[model samples]
Target: MEEFNLQFSTAEQCLKVIADEKWQEGFECRKCGRTNYCQGKTPYSRRCTTCKTDESATAHTIFHRCRIPITDAFEIAYLVCGSPKMSSYELSRRLETRQMTCWKFKKRIMECIEHGAGLHLFDIPQKSQV
Candidate 1:
């Protein structure tokens, strides 16, 4: 697998990258079938012009409702992706988060990753290191 070096000079940059990747193809309204709604001007907000359902861009991600700044979330994602295996305790220490919070975050992240495991994007085949 290729390594990805995360580069974000600012929280805004990280959020922009995530938003671009998540909605590269554009966003569709959950309420209606319209595909014309543009991303909201707010940093973390997105609005559906068709249904007027304004939503946070991070509404469904692991960072949803998280008190931590978006930069922390980006750092967490990077660390999780890069590590081969990590326990909640280890993650907590690395991220300077509470153990309980780490546990919860780990659970949700693993669930999300598992749910998408079947998809080709996350279905990386195991390779034997020579």
Candidate 2:
């Protein structure tokens, strides 16, 4: 793995990164399948121009269900990815998050990596019947 600085200094920067990754070309509405959307009230979301549906930058990604700030979650994920042996306690102390939250995120990340699961960190899986 390449040593890249994944630490985002601000929530806006983090949201931008997520948005860029999610919509490489441009914003596309998931509901109406249109390429037009308006800036949403939240920094991490957008509203479709056609269907008026809201979309989150973290939607359908590993960070989807996270309660912490997206930037903090990204930081924790980066640390975990870089140092697989680091414990949840250390992570909690470093990130100022709950140990259980750290553990759950780490567990999910490790499981995805170890099992070659479709939900691996970066590779978004295609839709399929389970």
Candidate 3:
């Protein structure tokens, strides 16, 4: 895996990289399948004017719903990408955060990757009674 500069000096840089990856062909309306989306006038985020579908640059990503700072988030991604076999607790230790938070982050990252890999949440098997 390619190593990224673990540090993101500004949130703008993080958003730029995320936007480039998520909206490579420009913003497309998820609801109407139209390429007529534009940045929202409001301070919230972007919106699809054509279909009225709204989205954030962080939508459908591990960074969504995270309260951690952008720099920390980038660090988490870097850690995960670099330490493939490390445990969640190890990650928490490295980040100097709670183990449970790291666990949640790990799970959410897994979910996002699964979604990217075309696996729906419904397709995930439930735990069976032993």
Report the error of model 3 at residue 86, Å.
2.1
- Per-residue error for 90 in candidate 1, Å, reads 2.2
User: Candidate 1 lDDT, tens digit per residue, 1-130?
Assistant: 1122246646777666756655667776667867777667678567888788876666544556656666655655566666727777887787688777666655555555666742112222322110
Off by over 4 Å in 1: 1-6, 39-41, 117-130
Each model's lDDT comes to 0.59, 0.73, 0.61
Model 3: residues with Cα > 4 Å off, grouped in runs = 1-7, 41-44, 111-130
RMSD in Å for model 3: 6.0
TM-score on alpha carbons, each prediction: 0.71, 0.75, 0.68
Candidate 3 residue pairs that clash: none
Better by TM-score, candidate 2 or 1: 2
lDDT-wise, the better of 2 and 3 is: 2
- Model 2 worst lDDT window (10 residues): 121-130
Model 2 has an lDDT value of 0.73
lDDT of 2 by residue, 11-44 (tens): 7787778777777777778688998888877786
Tally clashing residue pairs in candidate 2: 0
Give model 2's TM-score versus the native structure.
0.75
